[model samples]
Target: MNKISKRPRTTLEQKIMILNHHHKSQNSQAETVNHFKTKYSISTSSFSEWLKDEQNLRSLYNNSNEFLRNSKRKLNFKYDKINKEMDKIVQSALQENQVINEPMLRQHWCKLVSIYGVQDPKRISSFSHGWLTQFKKRNGISKNKKPIELVENDYDLFDSN
Candidate 1:
């Protein structure tokens, strides 16, 4: 029996590099596929599959440009920093015995969004109620109030019949 070896998977970066080179060369899609098949031993079906994903293709194209990629990385970093700051604020509020009811939570998030919105309009555009809910869930912030338990000492005081 003959055993067939599986081809190595292509990394996203490699795919991007190949696509960028193909685009710069201004070759037809078929020609590009043929070139990669001959050079890298990748299958035509694989190229077709990769190109079929419109969103991924667009992202790869955008990332191929250094300026666009750097801007995207910076924007992502800003969003991450905003999220971290918001988490700290929420944690501090919880530590201070503040209840995380919908109104209170929404108000807090609105203030944060407004504060950060001045620096980046895109940040404000991405804020939504759903994001708040996801944040709360991620931080383990619960909506239901937990009942306080009485200690044995407190029970003894109440037993003075």
Candidate 2:
């Protein structure tokens, strides 16, 4: 009797990664299948099985998009945290009548990443002038002024005026 070999099981994450790679590449479907088969040691029959599972393919697509969205969210959160910290530092300096410039801001960011042990210091340090400008615009923060603050009894002050 001939022995039948069992195919290796793959995780959803691995499947998603493969599908994303295939989606992003300029290769045709057949080329992608062949590439994945050779690279991952998967058989063409197994690839066919994967293709036949509509639900699995849909899940893979959704999961891939979700992965990208989550990555973007994490990066945005990092940027927001950096922006808030920078605002605090700049506000403190302004109180002391010191002007904070872009170079100073970049230095403060480097110091913050070093002190706080950010996961990817390079990401934090890779901010270009255009990126910094967009970040400031998005956060509505101005280097020349303190961030706007809402205070209690502001309506009373307006009434008095």
Candidate 3:
């Protein structure tokens, strides 16, 4: 008996790449699938599903940043509008040399979510540090950027004392 290696979950970038090749290729589905299997390790079932959702997948890729290619799951757009508002606020805060941290972002997100109301009802009132990380990445906001944090010791953690 041979041990079968589990296939890795494909990111949006990989899916778009594979789909583009598959569509542009002169080869048949089986042939294209074979090529993907050898190169990307994507299974036929996943290919079939991706093909079915081609329109959505392509749209998502178009909306996403190629350089910041998303993780296994696509970006959940429930907070998209909120994200724009937050982007403006972050930019202004950065201009004014405000400290950007997880708690501050969470509190701001809460206020925005309440004021704007949520697009997705299932969306929670609070966001996690992971969500904040993704939000920063998507907006090209760097944590290491000195302008965003004026004081070395000025942070939510240190302020609590």
lDDT of 2 by residue, 86-109 (tens): 667755765665544555656677
Per-candidate TM equals 0.35, 0.34, 0.61
What is each predicted model's overall lDDT from 0 to 1?
A: 0.55, 0.55, 0.69
TM-score computed on alpha carbons, candidate 1: 0.35
Ten-residue stretch with the least lDDT total in model 1: 152-161
Top candidate by lDDT = 3
Model 1: runs farther than 4 Å from truth? Answer: 1-78, 118-126, 145-161
lDDT of 3 by residue, 53-159 (tens): 99988876786565446567765665678887877777777677667766666667777888886655534466755666667777666656776642323446313
How high is the lDDT of residue 129 in model 3?
A: 57
* Candidate 1 lDDT tens digits, 60-141: 5554333333222222333565677766766676676654454444445556777766456554544565666556554566
Number of the top-ranking candidate, with TM-score as the measure: 3
